[model samples]
Target: MAYTAEAPAIAAGDDPMVPRIGRVRRRVRELSDVWTLTVEMEDGRPLAFAPGQFNMLTAFGVGEAAISISGDRDRADSGLIHTIRAVGPVSGALTRLGPGDVIGVRGPFGVGWPVDAAKGSDVVIVAGGLGLAPLRPLIYAVLASRKDYGRFALLFGARTPADILFRREIEQWRRRLDVEIQVTVDTSGEDWYGNVGVVTALVPQASFDPQNTIAYVCGPEVMMRFGAAALRDAGVPDTAMYLSMERNMKCGVGLCGHCQLGTAFVCRDGPVFRNDVLRPLMAVKEL
Candidate 1:
């Protein structure tokens, strides 16, 4: 028999890693029904992050919440922006915070969108309701590296027109020739004139090369599932579509069981996963 040699297994420690640790320097930058927080680096450094990645936020006495980074990916000096909706105890406390207030921040955690994978391909981004927060980072990433990809489209749907975040940013994207942006409401207010339908309905109007396009979706569970289905129906391959998952995250690291969704951990394995990898888990109600 001819001698054959096997390659040595690569060591995980040798891989280039994003620093897993972070610090607490709470400074509230903007607030509304949704609080836009900026956590300054204790050492006065900038945090590098991809779109769709999130952080574990801690209030003094209240518990922690997993929030996505909503700031500009290109602006490293800007720190991190967390657009938090006041839905619980910790979040309510966060809403009351303002400039110079102290809060603890850990991680720019979770798996982010596949920006590197989408490079050189057409991109279709779908976001519903609060999903915009996670999707915002990706939008900024794409725009900053605009020449790396082909045509881009963003389709967002909200419960009411008033619930939409990033209104000013959306207007700016719409004005750009490289991107196409659309907004829809499930139930329109009297002032809405553009479109009134589910976010999936708007997907059909966007141009994409099924073979060369990559799709991303973030929203409520139902919306993620349905929006992914819509993309599949529109000829996008199952492997090319990705969805962001939501779960209760306690420890930002994998030690906590709060974010386990079956065999996958939303906090560790993914906050963003390919459609085929997520299909089975997203269909289960208890997970």
Candidate 2:
């Protein structure tokens, strides 16, 4: 249950239930079932959003699904970009859309990564599989102001070489001398030559002061749990760790308790939470 982007239900003047019209400017196939859509609003206003924020995209007759905004944070004026996997009716419909097609757009809802709090401190990002899409904005933010922080590291894991997302873009990022990028796979085929293991295995290889570092993590629940544990073992404090939690969120707002985790609503209160608030909830069984 990863809600990559969980922003507010509605902005001023926009109804929460009513979705605005948007036209797909471009669509790129990232994987066999995943597509990245670059959309622009019908009225020409860009969808202003923060890092790790999410939006509910509607597929007209099909339905709507909450997807993370996966565009460069520095280019907010380019409307919206969402990376979606065709796993369901709504999402499949989204992936089928092509250039000039119309789609429905909703809130860029919820609180985002505390990137500002991380300024002046070392920053590390841990992501797995599709989890990287939501965290990409944060990476852009970090790279946009690389001088503000120290020792930037990105540790990512995918199921296989073909399963890796944003491969070319990630390789471009790897070219930066200031960033320490480590990518791993669950299984490396004969065509591939890279580390083969879980992403946490690369955490220790990152060069950052545990006491002075801030960590942002997103992935499958099991992966996030282990990643947090690995970071904790490396001496990073609980307060310095943040995670994006996912749930079956129907409404982008807090009205629906479908996304309730304990007493907090993932759509309103957070899709992102500090480890201090998340640790206890994650440790309990059936929570």
Candidate 3:
């Protein structure tokens, strides 16, 4: 008998169900409310991910959470940087871990923002609250290769002045002549002076080819739903509009069933989906 290499499976198989465990290199606090964690394969391999993909972040004994990749893939030292909000036990625990802490990583999972589909097309990104976390990579991707995209617009909203993430970066983006940055907050203080409304309010102010524009939206479910409607009203096609979804997930792989939505799994099928594809699902709850 001769030894032979196993042929790679063509069909989806058990391997897709297995999780890839990566080690944490460092955890840098990005803001008072969020932390950026960088993790890589113990074997020191680059994590190949497209803009908008998320990974399952696991802390030993605590549990797993789905986090979006926030680093530029073109950067060599870039690993996975999940900008996490401390909202629960798992996330709270994650905030405490520092350099040399170990965490489990299962994927460069989920469908990503359609950078390729939007090539040469006008891009509009609308994000609210921590929703900006997933959209960061797409922003970086477009700016890094600015010539590849056309008229760019970013409309972001937060609950309050304090809730805004990526403040410094947003300031830098505001200075660029090629891109537009519009920010709004749900509420405002005396010192705060900017657009004060839901993110939907900013859509009407944008000037772009609805027929040629692709919109990426992420936020609270209610906000996303409303944002999609606003885009349609602005004449952006449903097919060209996309949204990043978030749900409770156990296995970053599809085996756990925690993140299942209808026939799709948010972990595997998508964190990013066309607005038209999700419209039907948005009507149903926990399907």
Candidate 4:
């Protein structure tokens, strides 16, 4: 299949650093602390995004936060979805917004997942906690083009059963015979019947040819490092493993240097990077 990159839509006279007004179409509370907001440009233009790009959302008086675009890439009319956890002031303001509320949006920035390159290869997706939000679009792209890939396995972990994001969608994916889904939690409750352990423990259970598999991992920095090691043990080479790196991003562009890791800028060079390129830098504590 031919892959064509989608050019980001910009309104006339719009500045890349300036935020455009967007209206909240709907808001769904996914978990106790997490909320998903569906927002559309006030002008009604479709917000096009690749599988792993993000947007800097601003609440009028509040500050801004870099949030991954979590909606289906193919459905432009459904608006952009951002699953946010109210952990701080800016995020708290975003979560407090309801349908019809207006907010500022300034992106579709950062390099996205290499879903196209993974075609014909077995794919392993590993996500922990809120990291799953960024990987959600990649999963949609993969499943939407299911025939183009080999086996698909998803291993996800969260704090507990209640902390799991997209519970309904996860259940639906689990019901699909073509997809393999395993979930784990750091701690389990009496209501939880699934595995009780770190997400890496479920990595060995995924059935994929290590040589033919491409892995995408996103989570806490420590969790990502461990997940990459586990994938390595499973036979996946560093070249075949990718990770999403999170950092303090003051500017969506590389000019600010806030999101820099060594010589690379997370906002411009990547939010997604192959393990081989990032492994060395990740080992450095100061960076």
Q: Give the number of the best model, judged by lDDT.
A: 4
Q: For residues 27-93, could you state the per-residue lDDT of candidate 2 as single tens digits?
A: 9999877899999999787777888889889999999888999998679687688999899899999
Candidate 1 worst ten-residue window by lDDT: 1-10
TM-score of each: 0.87, 0.95, 0.90, 0.95
Q: Report the lDDT of model 2 for residue 107.
A: 81
**Tens-digit lDDT string for candidate 3 (17-73):** 455566678887776769988877675766667778877677889987778888876
Q: Sort all candidates by lDDT, best to worst.
A: 4, 2, 3, 1
Model 3 spans > 4 angstroms off: 1-23, 284-287
CA shift of 143, model 4, Å: 0.6
- The superposed Cα distance between candidate 4 and the true structure at residue 278, in angstroms, equals 0.8
Residue runs of model 1 more than 4 Å from their true location after superposition = 1-32, 283-287
Worst 10 residues of 4 by lDDT: 1-10
Candidate 3 or 2, higher TM-score: 2
Q: Give the Cα error of residue 116 in candidate 3, in Å.
A: 1.0
Which candidate would rank higher by lDDT, 1 or 2? 2
TM-score pick, better of 3 and 4: 4
Name the runs in model 2 displaced over 4 angstroms.
1-10, 283-287
